[model samples]
Target chain A: MKPQSMGQAVLIGLALIYLASLYFMSSPVWMGFTINALIVAVVALAWNITGGFGGMASFGHAAMYGTGAYASAILQVQYGINPWIAFGAGIVAGAAMGAFIGALAFRYGLKGSYFALVTLAFAEVLRICASSFAITGGGSGLQLRLEPGLSTLQFNDRSVVYTILLVIVALVMALTAWLKYSRFGAYLIAVRENEDAARALGIDTYRIKVKAMAISGAFAGLAGVLYLQVWLFIDSAVVYGSAISIEALIGPIIGGAGTVWGPLIGTLGLHLLGEGAKHLLHNAPGLNFVLYAVVLICALRFLPQGLMGLAARIGTFRKKEDDNA
Target chain B: MLEVRNLSKSFGGLKAVSDASLDVPEGGIVGLLGPNGAGKTTCFTMIAGFTRPNEGTVRFMGQDVTGLPPHRICALGMIRTFQIVQPFAGLTVQENIAVGAYLHHHDRTEAMAVARQVGKRLGMGAMLDRPASSLTIAGRKRLELARALATGAKLLLLDEVMAGLIPSEVSEIVGIIRQIRDEGHTFLMIEHVMQAVMSLAETAYVLNHGKMIAHGTPKELVQDPAVVEAYLGHGAAARLQEGHHA
Candidate 1:
């Protein structure tokens, strides 16, 4: 089998095992933890499109995520639109925002740290606007009226939400897998490797970057809609916070930046570690973040390529041992 | 197939390429030669659309492509190689070539196939799976040429492909260039190797101080007093003229 197909098989098998384990778990607490972790995984996977593949590290993905959440929430609260329609609108809004930012930054040749700061500024401006605007419910935030049903996108059962999140994560994983081997993905990698060379080879690198950003934004927006539906409330601070943006990119970095399964592995490990630290610290206010900082530092120091690189190294070592035998 | 007229470029007060022009007829090998800091690269960049000329026009196959971007010009069947080899370091040799193959083949399998074909043709088939960063300088140069060929370019602008090669390696490249030219591809090369340029190019243009000083067949160019003066000093040119008479 091709390496890509083998990877897909492994991902699908892991997903099946995860769903089975979730089905057997009776505790709502564990279920909630898994759901939240999976949500982070999805967001990180989306962020990888631009951050990892396109080599345009964005520190303000929270802006896209929050725009998605708020776009859905405002439509539902103001016009009583169906939640499903509002969710679609949120994805579109996120893509539009991504294109606007991409065009402005790329046109002016803003890159590296400057581009990252611009993205951060965009999120901060959006957060401030959302907090001050009356239409966005001001600082008080918007709370969706919970009408329990699949049609309403609200359910009494936690597993329903868990299953939906799992599907979304799975779809994102599949999309990433396809992108890893596609022509467009090659173009994105070429652009990332050497922009001038890519252009000389007949690639319009600007267009490719913008397209990757738009797709990334759309996925982030979808994650936001999922967050809103499950949590039933979203304040600007919660959705548009810098922490969300940081979390989106950190998972991929801690797993393996450019690999398909990196974000999922990274998110699961980070979230589980955070939850364990929280338990040990008696749910202390900021200790989880402190633990995250320590783990991030260690990951950067020892395993700069993340867990996937570690796994590959181990695999090679084992193969060498077998050859010696 | 390619025409550059009255091209000029200035980096601030320094004129990099001033009012320089050249042409490559279909299926011809054109050599661009100059001493250090002679603006051959600047002229090539303007023709390939990497840099806009201050005052000039670039016409490819009768279409004015003066201000078009590099990618657009490449899509119009003209491509240029870099002086410094850029082989996507993180990718495998085949994958690096596949990046250029992707321009024509949207399918990954097809692109990879083209990459394999190009790799074999360039004598890099054995290292197809090796990382591009692992290649030697000669290997990297061949990989660069393979990548340019993968783009299916009708007119290739090669910048110093023979700069650092040994005589044997240079001859190998000369043979490859001749084979490629025989297959009906046109090349405009910037070469410091006079023997390779003289052996390959039917017509040659000499640049001195950002200006076109002489143009002729390689044999004619070697005997030209002006060309010799630009390359060696006036005293050397006079000595060469006396030696010729003797």
Candidate 2:
């Protein structure tokens, strides 16, 4: 493999190894937190498709996540659908929602901050609708039965859920790697770099971005369904809240916006920092968030390219040292 | 082959281009010579699908492609380069050209091969791995040409690719363009540098104040009074008749 592929393989291998080790940990609460962090990582990876690679940063990604959650929840609670079928349906719903919002925004030429704001509005609108609509259980949320079996995709042991998310993160990571070498990824990045140049080169940037959004939405939606299954409950705020949107964007930004392993690594680091803060502060109410904000500000200010950029810089430095030797 | 008929564009109260027409035959070098605001770039934009002309038609290879988007025009075997080169800052020079090469060759490896070949042909072979943002102005100009050629477009509307280059660098580009022209690609170049355009273009059209004032060979345009007046002051055409050079 080329050095580029070598870097990607090493990064992905390390991420997979860390994720697999989570299954062996016996602590229930730690396992729960790990699973939640990994789940958020998936959505962050999804966000990276358009927000990172395509440079169409979204601030309301919870639209697709909430859409998937509500779709699956409504199916099981109201229509007597199987959990597995609802899972498939929910991902499709998320992709559809992605396409809907992407088409609406791109067709109107909304880009940069405008695109971000539109997506946020879409999520907020979905949250309001999910809360007010009767089909979505209105103010009350839907809950899955406490069945501990593979059939329902829920388990008494948290390890099963952790393993499932591992496969998902691994697959998405591989997909991100594929994009690193794919023609579509080149055009998408070109669009991100210079839309006019991309268009002049015969790239239909509109189609590429919409497809990226659909793919992104599918994973984010998958994360939402996964969240619903593990907790056995999902309400408007739990699924469609702006907090999820913020989380989806934050992990990728902190890790490395456009790299394959940036989202996972960033999410893990942030999760640990957050948990460590909670422990040191005696689980204080909002103090952890205060520290989180400070760290985020610092990350943005000093490490604009995030942790992956630092790693790349160090890698080059070591290579230079070796060349000297 | 590209032809523009009575093309005009106005930005609210300002007439950027008015009733301007140009024709480029196959495998020929055509020049659009004008002053700073002669609407040369505007005409290029309208022909290449970046802007819609308020009046007139653009026919490419016998098809009416007046208001088609740039990508569509590109697929129909025509491309344009900007006056200000916009390379993908995050990508390497190879990857930057590969974006254009991917138009015909869908396979990534195949596209990369085409990009490499085009880079080699354009004399930027050694810098393919370098990030596009690292290029000098002349390098960027070559990159713009390399990318446009990599797309396999038969006709190129270059909007001043040699705008910001040194004389030696401009000569290098003029040689590359001549080589490409020999390879059977049509060129409609908007050039402010008369020396390069005079040596390169067989046919020339001069636009003054958004209107075509003269159409002839480079030799004929140098002597045309209207064209001379467009460049120099008014009576300079009469002075040129008496063998007085500026």
Candidate 3:
């Protein structure tokens, strides 16, 4: 509202863009794509806290994602609870998993590649558990009864879901933006860059890293809740699979590793490219992975900092230009 | 004031710092001079609480702070710089300083203001917004020092800050160190640059093979025969004068 910082302007711009795009697109296909983009944005923003800023690369984000999905799905399917309340339950479950994993890994001195391996192993274990557990519908999966009521988080309309998703995406963006300048964020960056240096300066690297991991997990859980509401059904393939983890991990990396708004931009652009490639490579089944690989390679080779880094540079350049005039 | 009692550290079978003890008076520069691999850095690490001493007590003020974590020690008004410059490469020069300011202030505005003030004092004000990776070696050294100073630590442990500096830059750093000391900040500095140590240090400690071989004023240290034999080449004892006044 003050119009002093770039953050406010960027946030307002993102909201406006989401709203304008919603107005322009009337088809269910467009609505589905938009929701997917928002979901990816939420996951990427969650991943950024630990993987990007904290420099703790995780390949097992599916553990949190699956836990969230299952928690909400189970609550609604068995307990006759509303999806809205079940989402909160999912967040709590995800937070618990995050804290447990973060504490164990940090306390035991597991880091870098080993830490990533631990996360990956946890995700695989979760996937196997979901496949075997009766509570989660075993290998068959559980489907929620669609109670079409405002309180049940069920709307027989795509637009209502899309609108809710837009607000969630914006909220996630604003939270990450706030974190970018917080003391905890600075501490995390310091810990990520050099743990020894950060410690020498009196920053508790372990506690900060664990906190970041927990927060990241909670956001992933939130994303899971939204995903469940949209489809009103959950299965291990849709929730606990490695594919979901890969999608969550890659979205942030492709956009920008640690910058605000990177995840959203990366998700939006990648989903659009995915759709376009489906038409262009109608027969070549492997073209999707090929396109992703090419983009990753290009991003690593030329723009290692990602599009957000480029945009920041251009923004500063424009400011200098304006000053000169 | 700072005191190290029976401080010792061993790696494998070799004792890097053995039974070393020294007391640095408050609000004055004390030089630690030793040859390479003489346990000077090992002692600094132990005192700064980066490494645990095998058998030692590091007392600051009147507190028995043995084996305290580095940040906890820093919060109690003690901070040390590494021998090698380790600036946060992805962050700007000001942001690097802001990380240090994070210990004192929570608000970004106040922390940045403090960072700018410290940057200006350290002659890094102009390059505040520049990426840390872009700075020259001497500039990185300044950023390191500025960051340490920003933590509001009462006791500063500087490890060879003048190691890779040109003559003019060394002089500038010496002036700043002197100014910082004059402002009532205590310092325990390790330096191989004899000129800066001889000029700035009020008291000097000489270490050889992880032991405090000699302790006196810089002039007295120059005349210690044992110290001369340790540093001055064989049959080059007469050239010690040239080394001292160089």
Candidate 2 per-residue lDDT over residues A1-325, each given as its tens digit: 1223444446556666766676676888888899999888989998998888999999988999999888998898899899999999889999999989999999999999999999999999999988898899888977887887878878886777888888888898899879878998998899999999899999988999899899989988888888988888999998998888988988888888988888888888788888988998799886756766777788889877677765665445222222111
The candidate, 2 or 3, that scores higher on DockQ is 2
- Per-residue lDDT of A59-91 in model 1, one digit per residue for the tens? 999988999999999999988999989989998
Clashing pairs in 2: none
Q: Find the candidate with the highest DockQ and give its number.
A: 2
DockQ: the better of candidates 1 and 2: 2
- For each of the candidates, give the backbone clash count: 0, 0, 1
Model 3: per-residue Cα lDDT over A122-239, one tens digit each:
8888888888989989998888786877888877888888878878887887788788788888888888888888888889888898899889989888888778878887788787
User: Each model's DockQ?
Assistant: 0.56, 0.62, 0.50
Pick out the ten consecutive residues of candidate 3 chain B with the lowest summed lDDT: B232-241
Minimal lDDT window, size 10, model 2 chain A: A316-325
**Which regions of candidate 2 are displaced past 4 Å?**
A1-20, A317-325, B239-246
lDDT of 1 by residue, B82-170 (tens): 99988887688899999989988989999999999989988888889887888878999999999989998899999999988999999
TM-score-superior candidate, 1 or 2: 2
Q: What does the lDDT come to for candidate 3?
A: 0.83
Which lDDT value does model 3 have at B99? Answer: 95
